[model samples]
Target: MDWTTVEKNWAAYTPRVLTRWPGLDEDEVLATDGDLDRFAEYLAIATSQSVQGARDEARGWAEGEEPADAKMDPTRDNERIFDSAKNIPVGEDVYSADADFGDDRIPEPPMDRKAG
Candidate 1:
């Protein structure tokens, strides 16, 4: 993985780093400020691994990392206007006077009263 890329996008990767090494605190991780060597040092202390081992693990994590935007749920942005639209009645009830055939506009009220 490119350490430079990770450094350039540090804020996006911080959460993943914390997940990979929950023993480390957010303040401590943020303090590294995208320095690979400093991050490796923190990882080593938190995981009880050697600096080299921590570096290797960090590299592996970086390799597996995807952009945060790509991880968003597809359904999260969906706008459902009507939840009960899916439960339409069939057979005899299908031809009701109140059956809505996709026309959602509200009709204007009649101007029965005369202006003064």
Candidate 2:
């Protein structure tokens, strides 16, 4: 009843136990120390498909780590921000007030939307 044998057996059995219950944990295996062999055998019986499923989940998580869930906290890039700020046109004058003109010489285009 060596712990290593049990541990290795547990590791091998883990995927099997996980097949039926994807969320099963190592604690479940350790809980039955006396019946490690029987549990390992059970794991042997039940784990093939479930172990593969666990593997798939692990691989999916590994592959998907950087996609959306692994998003880090928002960061501030002061250099980039300053770079963009420097590019702002310095000479351009922006005015909100309208100009006052007395003469109306420009012909205005029809405002109504005509049928095409």
Candidate 3:
């Protein structure tokens, strides 16, 4: 991820930048307009880091690996309401005929079950 890539995907990257540097004001960061040098300057001022240090940090971040989902266009997609749902293990039997779980409960063991 080069500066050009970051600049092209500024909207998607803004949230990440704000999250990583909470001391930075949104408006000030937005004002940089995806200029890496300008952003580094702002970061240095906000975090009290040396200008060179801030520049290196910002450069590293620009060149770092971002999660695939972070690059998604939020406006065109619906929120995954069930994203937090538990995942069942592969090849695991979900329903046991021997279990006596009632209709109101799932067949899975209790989440807080202790080891024998």
Candidate 4:
């Protein structure tokens, strides 16, 4: 499949995925050129060339022939964008601490070992 089609599909599916797990973001879920290229390469290797035209061209390279397509630099949006988690300070009030000692204390030790 073309990268645009794959990305469009991902965009459509992003909401459902987010509904299932709110932690994930749309950008991260969308496919990147790198991801598409890898997938296409794998498809070319694993499946018959006739099955998918996209694989037909890459099948040779997948089978060890040199790649025909020149590798391109990643786009600005190629990588997923994410906001780092905010650092929240924890206060002592959140956790209470208490220590108690018995009325009886340890006796003094002998000053000299030889005395024993």
Candidate 5:
């Protein structure tokens, strides 16, 4: 596949991917060519297919075509790594420490029902 086709596929498929995984915002998704390339890389790995094959499969998905046979069982390690990946935020500060807004805070731990 040519660079133009790769780029075009990236642009078209990105929004569909984001919609499926709504935890990520489009702005926080494929913002650059490198990011788009990485997206394709992961997709290919997950499907156990070549980059071009994965791109073609995903293009069908983006076009509202019947689902192609791009899916395969990812390895356990790969699944864990994919789950662990943090969403890349755009134009926003990502504080290492999480903060909860003030006012209503739970001070005591709830009793475990399983203990009964």
Candidate 6:
């Protein structure tokens, strides 16, 4: 399948499931926000290319030839778009903190060493 078709599916099906069924009910799959569709679109495009590339590479390998894309960078990030995830600050409030123990706590001793 072409990437355009996958992108189309990403655009179409995204809104239908926005209000419900992001995945499961409990745990981290809570919000059915529309933002996830962007990820889906990204993944779909990546997956199609990846699958096709893998297939072509494998075929080339089987024929005793190097894969055409084997030496090329799959993601040519000229503007560092994909790298933003590393710089982004996520999970700001999903986690809660408890009270921290202070100077009054006793330190546990290290395990006693036995003769080798």
TM-score of 1: 0.57
Q: Write the per-residue lDDT of candidate 5 for residues 1-116, one digit (tens) a residue.
A: 23444354454545557666455456545764424456556667655789888666555545453122222223235744665556534533444333333334545446664422
RMSD of each: 12.8, 17.5, 8.6, 19.3, 15.4, 20.1
Residue 101: error of model 5 in Å?
A: 57
Count clashes in each candidate, considering only residues at least 3 apart in sequence or on different chains.
Answer: 0, 2, 0, 0, 0, 0
Tens-digit per-residue lDDT, 24-80, candidate 6: 233222232323443444333534545445344323323432223331334435424
User: What TM-score goes with each of the models?
Assistant: 0.57, 0.20, 0.56, 0.21, 0.28, 0.16
* Positional deviation of residue 47's Cα in model 3 after best superposition, in angstroms: 0.8
Q: How many clashing residue pairs, candidate 2?
A: 2
Candidate 6 has a TM-score of 0.16
Q: How far is candidate 2 from the true structure (C-alpha RMSD, Å)?
A: 17.5
lDDT of 6: 0.36
- Best by the TM-score measure: 1
Off by over 4 Å in 2: 1-8, 34-116
List lDDT for all candidates, in order.
0.74, 0.43, 0.73, 0.39, 0.50, 0.36
Point out the worst 10-residue segment of candidate 1 by lDDT.
73-82
- lDDT at residue 98 of model 1 (Cα atoms): 65
| Comparing 2 and 3 on TM-score, the stronger one | 3
Which residue ranges in model 1 land beyond 4 Å of their true spot? 69-116
Q: How do all the candidates rank in terms of TM-score, highest first?
A: 1, 3, 5, 4, 2, 6
